[model samples]
Target chain A: MTNSQRTPYDGIVMAAPVTIPYVRYSIESAQWWIGRALGALVAQAGIKASDIDGLCVSSFTMGTDSGIGLTQHFGLCVRWLDTIPLGGASAIAGLRKAARAVQARDADIVACVAGDTNHVDSFRLTLENFSRFNQDAVYPYGAGGANASFALIARNYMRTFGVSREDVGRIAVAQRANALRNPHALMKTPLTLEQYLAARPISDPIHLFDCVMPCAGAEAFLVMREETAASLGLPAARLLSTIERHNAFADDPMQVRGGWAMDVGELYAMAAVNPDDLDIVQTYDDYPVITMMQFEDLGFCRKGEGAEFVRAHDLTIDGDFPHNTSGGQLSVGQAGAAGAYLGLVEGLRQVLGAAGPTQVRNARLGLASGFGMINYDRGLASGAAIFAGPSR
Target chain B: MLQRCEACGAFAYPAREACPSCLSPDLAFADAPRGGVLLAETTARVPSDVYFRERVPWRIGLVKMDCGPTIVAHLHTDCVEGAPVRMSLQLDKSGQAVTFARPEGETPNMADDRQWREMTADPKFRRVLVTNGRSVIGQEAVVALKAAGAKTVFVGVAEPWRPFAGEDLLRRQEGVEVVTLDAADEKSAADLAADIGGKVEILVNTTEYVRAGGLLDRKGTSIARDEIDQAYLGFINLAQAFGPAMRMRGADGINNSVAWVNILSVYALANWPAFGAYSASQAACLSLSHCLRAELRPGGIKVMNLFTGPVDTEWFQTVPPPKVAPRAVAQAIVSGLKNGLEEMYVGDVAEEIRQRLAANPKALERELDR
Candidate 1:
């Protein structure tokens, strides 16, 4: 389908991006962090908890509970509700679902939230039963979880494109530098290029710094009619376009490219922008290789030119190209499904002039992309969203 | 086993419900082409599960099978990225099928690869226990295990005072150690366990009491009772005595406890009227082995069942020709352990019965009855 056939996301606006601060480990459950994010959203939007008639919840550690159970746990009623378990793709995917609900008048306000608690052993437990394909086909081999899966992808990508460890290090080093400016990012120390290169390997070619630190946290944003947001006097960002795809290119032996490449032409066409038009871009950074894939697939660079693109452009928040302005998941810490929304939340804040220390200058237009779910050999979900300042 | 979609001609792994391409439910199991290319590989230093954690630094690979599917396989150290490779399906410690990748051509010490070593319970350098070495099959099993590199073969000669033709043959084997234990006596098993249970790595149960009579053909239940005591009850005594020690030492260094071998009969799948009581006892032992498999799975210990057709021993002399030899059955057991196969059908008749049972159980049941 062409981009012209799709209806524009005209009146819906995303506002009140709330991050519940990542902790290396938490004694609390997923509900505790999700509840905090929801409460934070209500207080930040200056609306009563009951005003949100819709909810979109995403989490990996929510045992025997979903979006429906969450409403009762938090004491509210909703006309529209959903629970997205799409790991790193949950944020953009959840936002798109909430925006459509608002446009259809099914709910006046929809709260899109994702959260998970890392209880020291939760990451390992989650990987054990992540999916049927993963358990039967992938885990039995080495039980290496995502680390081993991504290592293969990184190694293949490096060999095919002649990308070096230094190229990958550049993305990580810049993200760590951006993390230093992000108050809520879990990594507080500065990182050197030498440190990233010299970091110990968890799986060959995937060093300690190349991987994200699993943590406990939550992120939430509200999707409502632009008029409703204006009436509430809440700062907001307008949705230009959003696209999501699952299990695309299942036949690719090597997953160096993601689903974004399948419909990227339409994503940019509907948003009516070129690659240069994006003042800020936030690509999911579960690993530095993913960011490089997003750069190639999202039209920031040609296929196999991700190395050249990162080499030529400065990715720091104050540099020529400001990417992952909130330090992304690699620096902020991957909080289960909350990691999926990391890039989208940062993109929304940037366009709304709300990103405090890591805000890009004159960030009027922004793009966020997500890739996730290594169900077996490779990741299976991809999504992206373009957001613009309310004035734009 | 590999599945090929009838509609789209595509191959799928992990047994898909429908064709991955055309969404057709019509799928056929076929032998897969072994050819494949190693797309990528890694050495996992940190494992998500405890079973692999003990065997850290496991080699893993992603391969694009020549047949059409991409598979995640255990990698041999010789398997290089972007190089041609071949695949084999080996049962992991869980007794579930896991594909493995190796070099296209044979490599030196391929069997010594860590992934291969972990999956296969090769008797190499590990201690073993063979029960009731008085039986021809039992004595042969002790010999086979020793030839496969077992450091010590503890042959349990039940009723030690009773003279057997092959008793001297078993006692003279280089690595063979004679121990007195009666399969029917619970105390004997316990006494043996107290002596060597802590060190026995592989336990091969080869006790059998064969009587050629159906239930209705026998007036008294004494013959049936003896069969149950040897095949069914004797299994419990051995499992209880040695199982705990073996399970506890699953992750104990390189020569850790690995497998429990159950020598059973093909008749266990479907009873033969000629030996109904014996078949029933075999069936009961098979069921218990499944339970033991689950219990020992967490420790990564394998429970391998070697099912053979009618043996050429005196008990099966009246049955028919093509009966598997006791020495040959012993060789099959060692081979199954080396290949990490959970269920192995040895000999022509055993393999034929296995195939017929899979294709049509009711037909095989009727045919075996006669």
Candidate 2:
């Protein structure tokens, strides 16, 4: 899918929490769980399997055939389909793929799904599947999984971006605080920077709390027309515009040239909106460093200023621009599919004024971004969504 | 000899590896009792987590030693304290040492009372429901709701699952009917709270979980998701199924009294995973309990999440547990309802988690791993 003449979709729907039994299987089973959950969600929306004209799914645990399997499992017959294989950024990629389908009029409705409970064998899965492509760069380090990979990313992010140990501590600490309010969240205990710093370090600048638990859970969503959404008693949050960029082969730091700043002028022009127009923002927070860097890339603040932005509590609900109001993956315990779908849920909730305790008052416009495909040093995919509230 | 650190006031186990708390190298061993009253404890349905799944259906708990330091340990089936109990820390063939117990005398009379025998003997008792609100209460309320006659009884819990402690509650309250919430998931927790109108008669909220540490000592890695899954599933699933029955019974002469039992701890407000997920999940369940109290009130169902610090149960082994007992904690929870108290404090630490929740949250980061 090329980025040209992308039109904003009227509304978006996220169908999730579709359960897939995966405790007994390998990580690949997580992909099947994702397919099952997404299939169930699309069926529940009363949209015929054949009516799903577009396909977008984000799965961290699946393979190339994973997306195709989603179509076959659900028996959705679509000619214009996309297969997005990014991990944490998979959902955002799917959303972008859906938006492109809508813009091209190739498909009227796009379905997005992500769910996995294949984390128990996550270490082995990474060695087998994740290392297949980056074996040269990753195998030499005996890198275990995303944790080991991100450990390196974190180490570099801290050195290059000037992020303090305290800053990393503060991120984990804040996530726990936010999670305390969410019942579905896995981790609800409180944490302090002092205890966080004192925790056994996995890699440099990364503590146990600094990484997300390899959890087993399921969640999925649907993207549809504004009218379709209203008919179902489901609230509608308008997607004004979207932009997708990839630097898959880059060796140098893409912090400055990543998706957030890669000529968003066209995206802004297409959406007819600016950075200051957003009220709530959901930047993919796989790691604290990615969160900070993406915050800058999306133009929330200047480059190299990501640390300053997060340090000021600017991303919390009480701040000027709240991010990840649903306690995020960091707080919600990182149920791969559910964690990614959270941005959409939070965006919809903020738009609908149903975010409850974490709602940003009078929120109208919001931005949700995702970063994924971490090889060793950085992310390969980043996608952003611009949503306008119901009041607008 | 087990002596409290004169400096930090913390009781040191096996003397000091530089006080786990203040980290002062200076420490002295003092005389500590070999046994004490049992504190809060739980019996496991299955062994869980990668490290310990092999040892299924074991009992793990906080036992307050006869001395001062509270510790966690694995207990044998015959282990009951306040009755005679011998403690031995043994290095197993696995090379890891854990404390064990051997009952030294007749079981405490409190453990073999009429109520305990009655509740434990009932075949239907396996599906006990602990309502965190006015879903069901004592004998009068239970009978009142039963007169209207619903097939199932939903017992609401104000906190997460502590099966062994919950059994203690049942033993104390004969024909004590209640419904547990089926809220391990998002929609079910909400549905269980919402579906309580006419079917449920008496709503009693036993809404507090036990905790021993503040923020610092709370260990995140130690507590796994499988444990949380088992605990929540065991508790909430019963609550969800019990709701429909209560709705069917609908408004007999059931008394609706909400109880928020408070236990004591200082960082109940601060972020502390070391104290365990039970605290935070209890807080989440407490929030749901509070919301249900308000939402289901019109439907004639009352909700209240209790906040209690710690209790003395057989759960407490020589490893150290809370100072209070099961009977005492049960009495406090039951009395809170009978006396029209909305929130009850069973211990000091229970109140601390509540106070922490009531106050502004501290600046803790959301990131756990990098």
Candidate 3:
């Protein structure tokens, strides 16, 4: 691919996420959450909803409605539209699609939103019919749900790498401490290592703290030309490089890593930056073990040294390795599809100097990685983006 | 059965129509080897479905079969992670084929094989008969059967003249037929059996004679005799009466009976001396049910034995805390029937007792001795 085709957008101007929390049960539908995110995007960007010529949306419970239906419902005549259902990887997926669309001049302003509402039965129903493979293979075995599947991976990771629960517990406790500064975070209470270790096991090897609390929320961002963002006087984050891979390393007996391992070199090469150069790192923290895996796969550490890396680094917002500064989904509450966008939006916020209390000092360049869609035993989609603040 | 791709020689689980590898439509089904290495295991303390809520703390494992396929299957309690397991295919409650793995040399047809029982649990459109309908558990069973879409529910009353709390409600419900029969009386049981044996698809014996006391109590022997007369003889009479007809029906291909459920107590598994005679009678009943289960296995009629602890009923009004609600037990029975579980330990106390027995029987025995 040509450089223009590869790094299409001059920059991405992301809006503050419209997050709704603690709605463990909601009467509203997926459309309402998506619309709310769109409203927030337009208001934050100081643009009219009608000005949005490109639309990209992601939701798990949207039910037969993709970008086409969303366009009609929101009364938008878009030149480009995409529906990313990549779960945690959706935010980066949406950004990549919208960025390419803008570069191609298909649309000037693209509104990319990912949101979902959690109802009493939505979580269970979603798992039951997640996929034919899950329904037939994984679900029937004790109906262990997602926790059980992740438990298998966590156990194997520990056994293979000699990682202890204390090593993983450090991530959760640190993230909880970070969530204390995030007003939008659901779990603001201080989490001690003792508490994380003692928390009841949902599935063996995965405790309550190890699992993400499913809530209802959304996050959105606006992608447009550099001239457009400059005219609006909005601070923009330059999209240095983004990479996505699916079903990578399908031969592993159990997932000790993700697709990021396969493409991290390409991502760093394209961005012209080393892993050590990034100011802040935002990883998909669906589980602490996954965060450790991302750190290794994204080239922050050597393979099989994730546990050692985690043990050696201080991961709190103010620490040496500023990671998941906005508390991540672990504390922010995973709002269905919004989980995919959480890290990307946070990365944008960090680069733009909008991350209030959890802001890393002198934050300039940031890395955001997403992993999602556990089709059966392991997550299939992985995407990451490196963003740089606009030149002073 | 597992599917193999003729083009690439790759084997796939769930018997897919097309090859996942090589994109070959020429896939063929063949018998899978009964051996696999247990890759991982988890004790699911939380359940995601309504049917599994009562059966929490179930062991599930991922097994990599020797034939180049991995399957998520129910693991036998004896099987641990990293151990080699023998695999067998069994249908789940949804009528979908599911693999079950057990420790090697443990026959899949063993009496404690839970996977074999789950295959027979779905109670949709099956005709049901609940013996001893006067009690709370019996009434709940009838209600659960109706909710599960049983075509017809026959409520067998041992004492027709006695007043029961839910008896009138049961008689008033649609599709419920109340019949009179004394389980201890062979003639009455035979007469009732002759009446509805052909039509009954799910038979549940909830008869119990519990006189709570230790062996030192003056009336203990009489209580034990009555318990034996009612619990054991009652189950035997019902099984003998229904087993023949159920087998014949299975042979006839017209409404083959699905299962026979016995609501015994957890004490039967590990004799709790506090309820000495009651426990002894329940133990006898449990043994008889196993024999009956084996006898009816050829006809595909599952025998579901429920081992529950103290339930919230008049029989256990004095039993404090940790008692299971009658509706919960009833729901469990219906779920058990639908899932075709051979043996189910319901209620928190029962599950605790089960785990205790599995972990250290001598410790449990010593505690009971105290």
Candidate 4:
């Protein structure tokens, strides 16, 4: 398809996000959380489950079952099905795929859901077998898990950019403040810079505050034509643009930036907006260093200046930047694959004027980005999307 | 070694079969660059797998080599991030090609040296000599050494008049030589050393007298003298006679002696009153072994000392149920010789005593006294 003929996602709306609260550990399975999320999405949309003709699912703990098995279990038939196993980037990937399918008249309504259950052994098991490269190369050193890998990145970033621990502490403290206002956030207690710095080091340079608490939960959203959303009497958040890239800089000895840096300009150009136009920003906050990298790579600042960007901006809901209003994964525990959808679902809630306590005033345009799958030393998948309110 | 593609001039690490960039089968293996830059480093305080659990606080890092391959290598503790490092590939305990990086100007640790690893490999197809071969430990060592593929095994018997239970079977075995020599007699040791000095690649000394008594025993003086004569002086005479020949063989590069193993009692570290004289003799042997190790370093001969608890031998027949089996001790000796370890503790009690002594020697002494 030509660029002109390729469908723009301006009128493709994402509606009816159903989020389940994150629990620290559970014996429940992925199917349980996914069923709850799908059920909640249909209930919030005030539609029958059979009305959904397309499905896109994301889950790391969903053993031996893909979209085909889920379709059979949920008893919903559709022409489009996608199982985006992109870890934390699955949200944007699922949305991009479902939006294109709808634009192509493949399926009218698509249910996008990401969920996972975290047992006591789930996080350890996931890290042990995350990927072949990770299992062989990284796991043998020390079971530092993701914290070890991220710590190395954080150390490199600090050494390169002169970023201090306090610079990242600012993000953690601010996000915890936002989490206090978020009912779905697992960690609602106020966090201070002193506490962030004083926390015990899980890995050197990556303290307790820098790591996300792995928990069990689910997040879901519905992707359909804007007219169909309007007909259902639901407020719609239009997806303006989305970009996903993997293994972007294979030559970099160390990952100072992510794949977002490679495709972020195209993301903004396609949406006809700049970073300044964003009323709210939701970045995957598995680690604050990563958020800083996203800020620099997504064109908020120059390369290697993420620390300065973090220092300059106050990222609370009431602050000028208004980033991660739903507390991000720092305060809101990460629910395996659902972490990819957490920011997207929250961004949709903000633009649709449905974010209860953490909502920003007159939030017309928003940005949500994701990163996932640290297969070896660096994250391989990165994606971002811009959404707008009905006025746009 | 690193592989280079003839078609595209691209380098691939771990010796891939084909070029990753050009998919060409024309690949050549060549020596990897010695220079590398330390990209990032971390000490795994909590090791993820069982293999590294005991070796916690392991320093590992990513090193980008000048030849264009980034490797995950065990970092020398002194190597700083962002600094240039000397890198090389070595086989780990699991026999995998593991990269190791050290700071410039610092010698590579013996643990990460390929030559050291090869030198410590099993004494396969090598001629071996076991002193005091008529004893229980010596017979077990003979069986284990033969099983490990020794080309010829010499059993040095001090007293042929007293027939050992396995002596007939040992004599009937192929490539087994039963030599008559008393370790206490200097002439006998020198004569035996002269006969097989050039061919013997592994020499084991399991000669020890178990005179179990405290310092105040009525026969303590004679017992201590016998123990010293067998354990300490015996090793010294054998080394003095055989060492020169071993060094000459090494100089001439004719399958020289690679290892000298000494089996001693764990009481050498922390003396138990019941075995005080034996402990004193073994302690002296340990000291002499260290000196021998330093002296033999120029000739590339490894000195391995095995400190073990009481074994279920005739000498330790009255020892408690926790005594180690003779076969186990023999196996430990073979492994220690193969791995080229400077020192090893055999049996649970021996390891425990070693740990206790390391933690606090005074406390261990007090515990042994009690």
Candidate 5:
């Protein structure tokens, strides 16, 4: 809790299983998946579950009742707990929360996790069902899922942000190309602006390819005091700083501009860092539109210059700023809760010199984010976490 | 194309005779703009004996008109939930209804979907099943699911069960499983419950049994059946059979107990029907939901009920109605189940009910003939 330079705490260990249950998502599965993943991490790190002092989880489908209840079910003896409800942003938020707990001496070791139902039908259910966002103003208007609604926002974003339809397509194309190098990516096909634009639009500016595939999976990590991490001989990453805010219905009242993008500056400030200091960054990208906005908001490049960044600069490992080296949600296969964690894991591995192919060279610091609860016409609820290299 | 009524401030699809709000005969036709969010959509199955079996599992949607109104339009692609749709003037194949397509950058051409095909075709997999009543859409969804290579069974729920009956429809679809239960009484409910003692992967309850006819022809009046208590029996019976069956199965499988789908007119949820008995019965059905949810949570059951409005069925066809379709209602219900929802309000009526319930708690009692 210092100025621009926040003191380093302990190293955080993140872990997760690669697979998502194909069946419909349920509370039991959520707890099961999370517990299994965490158990593996505990064994790897050589720590007892009870010895872990804090727990944090993020999931779109797991409600509060289910999230809190999972603690007892998982048999985690922890003094602190945090449940994050943002869609793709959950993992990053959990990390930040764990960082705080570690810094506060709330716990010596913290576990962060995510999970979801990978079933396509259930994906359909999550959208058409009485979602947290669409219970009222949306369903009656035939605004189906986040894709359709975000398309509307993307349409307006393109208009307001001065991004050409090609620019959006460019992002999709580039991400797909980047995903090709990552084996875990869902989409690896090389894409072009022509192919992107030629594709049929699900909504105005949003194309089918412009959105990430609905995936179900989980990811996790462990965070503990730096001294303890080294003493245990565990690989680690530094949690620099974090921040979270809820902007429900920000667009409805027309009080705010760019729901998720609105607070990029604030997020950077909370982390006591700027977009410039990061060697790598991971934004919770359920859609390409949100991805572009993250760049603009996070100060990676400039506002409405996201498309330019993709086209002009190289975000690939060989390029200037490395992004979604794991192919991101676009290619990385978004398994809901674990997706963000996957990004964080990849980031940590890069910083730890562990990523085999998708690694950003000489990576020392990384920033991760999660955005969720697409209320009204925008995504107001978001969480951000900044991480630095494991102190030598 | 559908248009919003100048009088009622609501969207109307297929152009209607009068404003459903005010009895104004000043109906104006308007085009449903392309490029609206897909609020909800589903696929449906047709009997082989039916003429449109080839189109059996097709996609249809409750599209929001960019202007204001909402219409049930055909979803051209296999994409149900997140797929964006561009409204356009197309032949309403079903009954002069308008349709739309994906706009530019909306969807990739079929050939470009090589990766999607490769991913979908894997045997070990992850797959999602989305239904459409139209065979074209249904086939597309199936193709997509198959291409994803996930073990998927996307069943299309058809509309109008009375004339053909749910059992008869189940009989026609070979290799498909069926859970039959009456939507009107207790004995049938018990029988259905016994039949489905355990084996069930996904349990969806979409049975609505209501004796329709205005309670009062005039501005306000009362009708019987409110005291009869027959309607309540169907819901309870079906829940007993299916809800428990899902619980018995695996906690991971989805259990959707959808009740009160597209049967209400404006008076039902809000106006406080003149038929107090019917209203009371339906209200009671909704009340039992809380307890069932609590009891089933330990079993990992995800329960969702549909509080839907009018649907275009044999019942609605005979009576004048809004731009409602039976197929549309079915699609929405299935979509809700996919998102892991607990409750879904099909149309604007849900909001109307909330308003009435919050604004005037006693407004529902006005229908009582007391």
Candidate 6:
């Protein structure tokens, strides 16, 4: 099989990034959160409610509701409607599908929305019956949810690559520092490297700060052709390139690299950019170890050099790297599928110079990557999309 | 047992319908090579569910097998990354198959390992309650429990004022106390439970009333009635009395109440004409144990059923050789308790019946009478 030339995103652009203010726990259902987010997206775009002709919804707590269900609930009638079930990769994956929809003229504008409501016990309930493979094989062992599995992955990756707990602690500490600047981040207090190392382990190798807090919220954005955005005079971020993969590197005994490693070369090739050209990067960071893996796999550093890369550079917004500049999910609470969208939305804000306090200086180019859905041992979905400032 | 794909020759776990590798529909479920290396492990200090949360510091790991498919398994404390581990499929309290990893090399205090403790009901320093002491099987159970390091073994002697043959020796044995109780009488069971219910870590019910006769040979329901009282009704009395207390203490320290044992006959699977009344009673108790398991599972208590062949006792004088001895039953009970096995078939006849029943239930039922 030969690789075919990829289609360019061309005139497609993303605009009107909306975050529906996360809360620790919400008495309201996922419907309320999604409705609020969709409402906010329309208001921010300064468009009529019916302007969003196509819809793509992503959520975990909406029960039986998907994109189709939301259409009736929100009175949406559109040509193209779908849902992304990729969990932490939901928004990035939704971006790929919606971008193609708009490029192919399926709809004039597509609203990509991800939301989830976190009740006190909903997180545990979701984990208890996460999936068939998980419930049958993983949950029965210790029922530690994702924490236990990632601990193993983290421990193995550290040993395999000669990384240390201190190196892993650096990721969490820096993210917490970045979180302090973002007023909406769940973790408000300043964090130090010492506190990260001293934090009691949730699962060994994964400390308290390494894990994301579960919260209720929604994130949304609009995908449209440049002509459509120009007519409305909306400030939008141009889509440079994107890549998506599932269950990649199936033969590796341990998940040292994700699908990003396999397709990262093409990602940069399609974007017509080098790794050094990016001004900002946002990696799906449910855990600090995963962030390290992403940094190495996404071409920020060599495979075994992620530890040294973190040590050599600071990761806070004002620092040299400025990765996860909007605090990521490590500081901002994980809002189910919205956790996947956090990076994409934050990346859009940075590229468009729309980020307030957490904005990167003179941000022109950025990348948002996602990894999610641990059906059994490791996460299956991997995706990334480069966002640039409307091609200058 | 793991499934092997015939087309791709790759191994798949968790009983899949089609091959994960080749998408081959041709698959065989058989015992695969148990060799595997521990990839990573975590002793989840914070568990997700109440069942595991109560038993905190629960260790689990990722194990990629010599065959294929990485599995999440209950890991022994000694299971370290890059070290070899042997895997086994054990039935949990819910009667579902779960993988467990054991160290290839012997580890110190192996029985004390959390993984072993989770899977077994080892009678080490835990209090035990035996519901009957009149039969040879009952007497030997007391002796075995004491040898297995039971802190206290309470022997329930019905109508203790009327002494049994081994009454003097049982009372004289260290850590063994004879208590007054009658399985047939509800008050007797309740009284005994009220005294020692909170402390009984393991309960062994060995009350069996047997007589030689088919349903047609029996004139009245007199003999059948006695068998039902001792086997079926008596079991109900003990379970009702002691179940709640054991459940409440299921997650208490090492001395926590663990398992309830039932001595059953393999003939319960298929009735034996010669001992029709006895077989019927055994079947009834076996059915009830399944219900008791579900009820006790929420509290993490286990209801283990021990199936045995015809025992060599006065009641089986007319039967032929190849009978299970009382001592053998006692030994099986102790070992099964240590293993925390839900079902144990003792003696050649019991094992034979179990296999035959699995292969062909209807055929075994027809052959049992012959």
Winner by TM-score:
6
- Which DockQ values do the candidates obtain, in the order shown? 0.76, 0.01, 0.46, 0.29, 0.03, 0.80
What ranking emerges by lDDT with the best candidate at the front? 1, 6, 4, 3, 5, 2
How close is chain A of candidate 1 to the true chain A, as a TM-score?
A: 0.98
Task: Name model 4 segments beyond 4 Å from true.
Answer: A1-7, B2-6, B13-18, B24-31, B47-55, B90-97, B107-370
Q: Categorize the docking of model 4.
A: acceptable
When summed lDDT is taken over every stretch of 10 residues in candidate 1 chain B, the lowest stretch is: B47-56
Q: Is candidate 2 or 4 superior in TM-score?
A: 4
Expressed as tens digits, the lDDT of each residue in B4-75 for candidate 6 is 888988889766789988899999987799989988888788887877777888888889898887888898
lDDT of 5 at B222: 30
What is the clash count for each candidate, in the order shown?
1, 117, 12, 4, 61, 0
lDDT of 4 by residue, B1-370 (tens): 6788889988876455778688999999876678989988877665456545555656678778888877677776678888999986643433345567778675655333433334363566678888877788988899999887788889899878888788888889888899987888899989887787778778888796887787776443776788888888998988997777765554333244677889989998888887777888888998898888777766667777888999887778777878888899899988877665677889988999989998999999998885
Best prediction by DockQ: 6
- For model 5, the interface Cα RMSD in angstroms equals 10.8
Give candidate 4's TM-score: 0.68
lDDT of 5 at A273: 70
Candidate 1: residue A172 Cα off by (Å): 0.8
Candidate 3 versus the native: TM-score?
0.70
List model 1 lDDT by residue over B1-370, tens digit each: 5899888888898677888788999989989899999988888888777777778788898899999888889888899988999999987777788898889998997777877888889988899999879889998898889998899999898778888988888878898999998767899999999999998999999987888888787999898889988889899999999899999998888888999999998888889889888989999999999999898887778999999988989999898889999999999889988887788998998899999999999999888866
Query: Where in model 6 is the C-alpha error above 4 Å?
Result: A1-4, B6-9, B25-29, B91-96
- What tens digits encode model 3's per-residue C-alpha lDDT throughout B20-45? 77889998887767899888887787
> What local lDDT does model 5 show for residue A236?
71
* Model 3 ranges off by over 4 Å: A1-22, B107-370
lDDT of 5: 0.55
Estimate TM-scores for all models. Answer: 0.95, 0.47, 0.70, 0.68, 0.52, 0.96
Give the Å shift of residue A203 in candidate 5: 2.2
- Which 10 consecutive residues of model 2 chain B have the lowest summed lDDT? B115-124
Tens-place lDDT digits, model 5, residues A1-392? 22444444334443221233222224354556676677776776777777777878776666445556877887877788888766666766677667768767888777777776554355655655535335433432333456555655665566666788777666666667777887667665777768888876555555667766666566767776777777877767766566666763331322123344555655566556767888887777777777777777666777667778777766676678787777777776767667667667777777776777777778888877777766544566676677777642
